[model samples]
Target: MKLVNLYPQKNIEFFTPDTSTKLKLPVVTNGISAGFPSPADDFLDSSINLNKALIRNKDATFYGRVKGDSMIDAGLSDGDLLIIDKSLEPKNGKIAVCFIDGEFTVKRIKIEKDVIWLIAENIKYKPIKVTIDNDFTIWGIVTYIIKSV
Candidate 1:
């Protein structure tokens, strides 16, 4: 039997302003905790609009679903929704979606002296050094990763 992907199989694409899905959820006044117990705050005190919170630049922001485990150590996994923004500068240590040799791959940007390297979080995948022979473009900077439960 052929297996179906529960997550979308397409490259993270740009978000249009007229997307049919828009959810506005309530945001607690206090941040959710991972440590000791805290008192519960009143409900509906504030709201967290994902579009506003997640997309800093709506026009340049896009979405792509991660396809592999090459970046597991960086907290990236298969099926995670990656939020990328073209407007953001690709700085050192920032994760980016890159286009190389006509293919798209996601990796962390590393600039060492005069060289550029696409470093993978997983050891199995070797870091690729950018050279004159390769086609490369820092498509966008990853701002957030939405993990699926």
Candidate 2:
């Protein structure tokens, strides 16, 4: 997959998903407990390929490194990796990566009768209302978010 530097000034770095790399990693069959520790035997029963597991549509999938805190309340933080699928339908309440007036932003979509609203999860950030005069496009629907602890 070809990677492109799209809208660096907009705080989003875009890259095409490399579905060709199939790296199988051991997966724990039993769920990990948050409160207590458990036995480790029989946990690694199977393997998983992250490329296959994450990329639902290889041709339409893209990765974007987030660079802002607009969606911090939604668990998307700066430096978080976002898996976006262009083939997915952009419905109301879905988190999406959008291009508006030549800038890229990730926000929850709110579909009104005649207008689209980009709602930020942070209370400090105000929602952006998209109008017909502005150039807008729902680039892709955010499917998964990979974050570092």
Which pairs of residues collide in candidate 1?
Answer: 12-63, 12-64
Top lDDT prediction, candidate number: 2
What is the alpha-carbon lDDT of model 1 when measured against the actual structure? 0.79
lDDT of 2 by residue, 1-149 (tens): 45676555665899887677778999987877788898887668899999888888988988999888999999999999999999999999999999999888999999989999999999999999999999999999999999999
List residue ranges in candidate 1 displaced over 4 A: 1-22
Q: What is the overall TM-score of model 1 with all chains considered together?
A: 0.85
Off by over 4 Å in 2: 1-10
Instruction: Write candidate 1's Cα lDDT for 1-149 as tens digits.
Output: 11223224335333433333466788776777889977777645776668777878876877777888899999999888788898999899999999888777899999788788999999999999998789989998999998977
Clashes of each: 2, 0
The weakest ten consecutive residues by lDDT in model 2 span: 1-10
Q: Clashing pairs in model 2? A: none
